[model samples]
Target chain A: MRVASALLISAVASGCSGNQSALDPHGAPAIHMEHLIIGIVAICTVIWVVVMVMLGVALLRGPRAAADTAKSEAWLAMTVVAAVAATVIIIAGLTIASFYTTRDIGVPKSDALTITVRGQQWWWQVFYAGADATPGFQTANEIHIPIGTDVHLRLESADVIHSFWVPSLAGKQDLVPGRSNSMLLRAEKPGVYRGQCAEFCGLQHSHMAIMVVAEAPADYDRWAASQRGDATMPADPDAAAGRGAFLAKPCAACHTIRGTAANGTTGPDLTHIGSRLTIAAGLAETTRGSLAAWIADPQTLKPGNNMPMVPLTSAELQNISAYMESLK
Target chain B: MGAQNRLTERTIANPAPAFVAGALLLLIGVGALLGWLRQPRELRLDPPAVADLDQFRRMPNGISGTPPESYFALGKPYETDAYNLSQGKRLYTWFDCATCHGDGRGGAGPSFLDGWWLYGPEMVSIVASIRDGRPHGMPAFRSRMTIEQIWQLAGYVQTIGSYTPKIAAPSRNDNEHTRPAENRGPAIILFDEGPLGAHPDQGPSP
Candidate 1:
């Protein structure tokens, strides 16, 4: 009995709160959504109970006789009229509430911090626009924002359609090819909000996750300043040799490592790759081991992704992963 | 009430015919869905494309230099296959065709969007250009790519110059890309601005 009740309680509360659950609202837009959800569900529950009770009463009273009184018929007509009126009024109120909530989510102005997000096969390429004359920089799979600030995201796709949805921050918006779409992302508290590509975009879509890091203004500024600079030269001898190997191989032709000759644009820029929280769009945490594993065999870990396995010696692989980790 | 009760009793007594028919319909729908979903994410058009090379002869221009009329059909099988076209698109990126082509706009290399073919938009000609290399610094990719891969690239290249967008034309990344992104649009958004190589003996549009 104890085990069965424990299982039941866990199941019941599983979706009530979590990192990715819509029910756990942390931003203004989501709070509005939560309000609407609670209001609608509460109203519907009350109506359902009343309906069931009325149904039971009618069944208990039995079927009416063939010759009904005029007074009884009049009462039945009045009850139906009241029910129809109530339904229309309730639906109209809900519609009005929804309309206002959607419109009031956020209207981004030119002054808001603008970030351009490009959805690739199974990852996100994020570019942070510079403030004043600070100069912008790019990162993959991670976005950083200051709490209590309005973030304007210019969403675009590199290939197919993908939707950006962070249930804790904002509603879902699609990134369509050949055109640009915009969305407002904001947070009331400092925390990491998880997001993912909510569209069916080919084979590795399930692994296309992103994280929005909300921090204090001073912390965000410091982080952005560090990102704005080029990658630091590695102090370790192994990492320096790994850099030489990376530029010598085909990796240079597809990726760009700033302050170096690796200016290829076929893949994500690895300028500040070490600073990112996760690699391969949240496939794994950012670690030397995970980076080496991903580099050695991308097609196996995330099957059908565009990263083809380039044959690497164990030593070269080690040096490169170390070099990547040292970029921070 | 009595009539409705009798109707419910009749359905409960004879359920097999309706159930069997419903099951068969559901099975057929599932079978079709499975067929589509089973398309592997690997290259499937490469083998036959390699087989075509035995008869593959090419004259770059449509005149005496052009190959026989059968050469036109080399790109037919892949022209409308979305899967094959997308594969060719990927190869276009991996090979760094944009270094000179500039997203097929022809910066250092001749443009593919002008609808003006130095050689006509034949798969054979495109393959020859890729494998054997063309004039004015066009490097030969013969040593770099397989015959099958070359054909796939050729098919994608031919579509870049098409005036009417083929429904099967490959799609590209949606970004202000650093280099050649030929498949950026569903079809060629043509502009006659890229640098043209001096092909003094160019023929009319075929």
Candidate 2:
């Protein structure tokens, strides 16, 4: 029993230490929260132990048959004093921690990048803020930000309520339907972190995940620059046929690829889908096979998703997949 | 004995106090229920839309008494129910109709809430247009949405430019776009300045 208890305790302790964990924070806000959680857990454990010890003592030593009045009064006064002291300390600590953390986290920096993230039913419509000279480009699912730079996200929902939560980076903020909310995120290190729609949205909520790729400033800029360009035209005949098939089919009705007739906005923008890390709202790998399968039967992969199953022939599906692969 | 002396046991000894407390709570609950029941129904803020089948009778296709081919063969389901209209509105947004149609004011496609429709102002015509997309723009949705959904959308579309019974008052959180009143004809609205100099005979016409 002792061995099993030790193992279980270790497992629980290590569970929140993953790369995408709040306990293993990579950003300032997450770090603060992690400290706060640790402090709370420690204080609670101590309190529990003290309470248990008192219960044990009380049980082991029965109440006095004839208690001395002065001694009993002294014990009562001690207990009350200790309780009041603990309460005051706890309240002060919590208030100070909350005020500091709330003020610091999501505080916009002068050089912070502003991005708009529109939460669809099961996908993210991500858009970088446009400069005066350059129009903003739209992408889906994956968000690339510069490492160590504050990133502000304007959260909006195209449909139901969804939450933006990157546990290692920042706290969760709800994206309510028909209203816009904002949250700030920053990554201290250059690495990939998984994000999820923290809200319990409709079907396929588990599949509605996102990836945050924190790259170096130069790399992020290069990615942004490349993404701003229209989807590259496929040179291969099969890919060309795929593009043709895409335009000819109902695919064009709900997706958009810049510089093509497939300007649909009901779904996520596919201008840079080929270059993305994952597809189907981070549910599948970004591969030709997965892309083809997703296009063939979106309903199967994500039931109740807005993208209906488009009846495409096998050859056309392959062609479309090729064209999609050649998009970058 | 000392501990017992220090602490005093409290009990509800008076029945009057208990009865009075219970009565007050009951009265408050009854008052709240009555107030809620008497509250007036809120006005709906959805765009004015009415799906009347009478408009279809004016069409040549309707006069011939021959049902049009493809989806919505059973004819447009005149759905004025708030829930159904909201569903149709969701479909319209989901289908990305707002992209080309500029939130009901003309953009790449002609405005649905404006005068001078390229196709006649019949619900059936709207259904047909959606089924068979026009040239230059307007992607066909026949393969995507179900016929029932198309009919619902047609019902919602018909509501534009028409008065509707208010259901709920508009809230500040509502982000749905409302059509501007000065709905310039499609040509002007599409280009933002003047009509596209394209030949009037191009593609289908009203």
Candidate 3:
């Protein structure tokens, strides 16, 4: 019994406190919900213990003589009423709290940043809705947001039903075909938060991930400008060769690269791909080796992914890797 | 006498049995209530950390039919030396047909490998399907694949349209000249469902 109690205590403690590294700079809503849950659990535990003790005593003491039957009946009635009342209160409180936390929090009446996310089979397509005449920027996998600002996302699906969830940033929003849903999120600090598709799409669904990078306003503007094709590429022989190979192959048939001959709208835009921290929808860290591996055999890394294997010689792979590395 | 008998019966009745039965019933009722209360609240019960829920939603709509007998009849001695059905297998994957056909069992789409063909069993009808496409959701592949490739793909289909994987013939050697005669599986045949057993004209029927 002592060992069982110890194990239960440990489990409760660990479940209450998530991975600190993962929860750092989490928005107020998530933190608030966590505390509320813990409080509810503590109260329920106390009630459970008291009820059990009372039940044990009642069983051990045995029924009193016929004279005490009225008192026993009254006690039983009170216990039932108390349990019912407590359940109602707890349910009502949780529902209300969950509603307020998920509702739009302090979104300014002024124009908000609007982004559209389309969930495809095992991938995410992100499109920035630009103001005025500027063409909106398009990207995949990685999402960037300005720190201390409200951002609105319009979620949709290309093929199946998918859900967008960034546990530390916001609640999940479903992406359904032929319809769109909206969600609001903001970052309190300049840091990176991980997100993933919270819907099972296909064999490669696990590989679909997104990086939410919170940057300062100025840094965000710079990144946005580069995404608009204002960024210049370094004039290196290896990178140049890699660029040539990229344009020559079927990569151009699906992907779009700003300021280059490769311009296919079927897949993600690679205009400023090098600046992103991770690749393959957050399946791996952004490195030459990882990128090379993904390009060589996407199915091996992310099974059932749409991207087919592009046969590249070892030398060509190295050259492409070097070129992509130089993009940042 | 009747009143005395009733009093005696009441006194002889065993109270323990009645108490045990009542207790058992109460226990069962309480257990059921506890089970109901333990159910998880409100949250969607899908698997955690799913990458693409969209893809999963779309898959169920495809491949909704029953599997055909031809798939199960593969590799038998009588079934050998028949038409090469490999073309259908290639077509199955190429056209994303498996998405609906689903391993040849009718799922979202009608089962082609089965003896029953909604249109007709004739090659002309199948070829027409390749040209015009079906009403529900099947797309015409005329614009997508070359005639030669389609014919080759169709040739492969003939041998294995009902070819279930369990009794699949051993992989064939691609080189025709070097392969031994005994090793060669079957003679490729192109047949028309209609009277003409030869290739038809390209133009649509008037």
C-alpha displacement of A62 in model 3, angstroms?
2.8
Candidates 2 and 3 compared: the better one by DockQ is: 2
Off by over 4 Å in 1: A1-9, A66-68, B1-39, B43-85, B93-135, B139-206
Q: What is the lDDT of residue B126 in candidate 3?
A: 53
Top lDDT model: 1
Docking verdict class for candidate 2: incorrect
Quote the lDDT for A315 in model 2: 97
lDDT of each: 0.79, 0.73, 0.62
TM-score of each predicted structure versus truth = 0.72, 0.69, 0.60
Show where candidate 3 strays beyond 4 Å. Answer: A1-25, A68-87, A102-110, B1-206
DockQ of each: 0.10, 0.09, 0.03
lDDT of 3 by residue, A1-328 (tens): 9999999998866643432222333655445555555666887798789889989998999976766778889998998999899889878887786566545343333478988999987778999988777778888888888988788788999868999887677767789988988877677778787788888876677878888888899999988877866335659888789887777666765677777876666567777778888887888887888888888767567764656455567878888777777676
DockQ of candidate 3 relative to the true structure: 0.03
Question: Chain B of model 1: TM-score?
Answer: 0.62
Error of 3 at A222 (Å): 2.6
lDDT of 2 by residue, A54-143 (tens): 899999998676568898889989999989999899879878977887888855865678998999878898989889998889999999
Supply candidate 2's per-residue lDDT for A57: 95
Whole-model lDDT for model 1 versus the true structure?
Answer: 0.79
- Order of candidate numbers by DockQ, starting with the best: 1, 2, 3
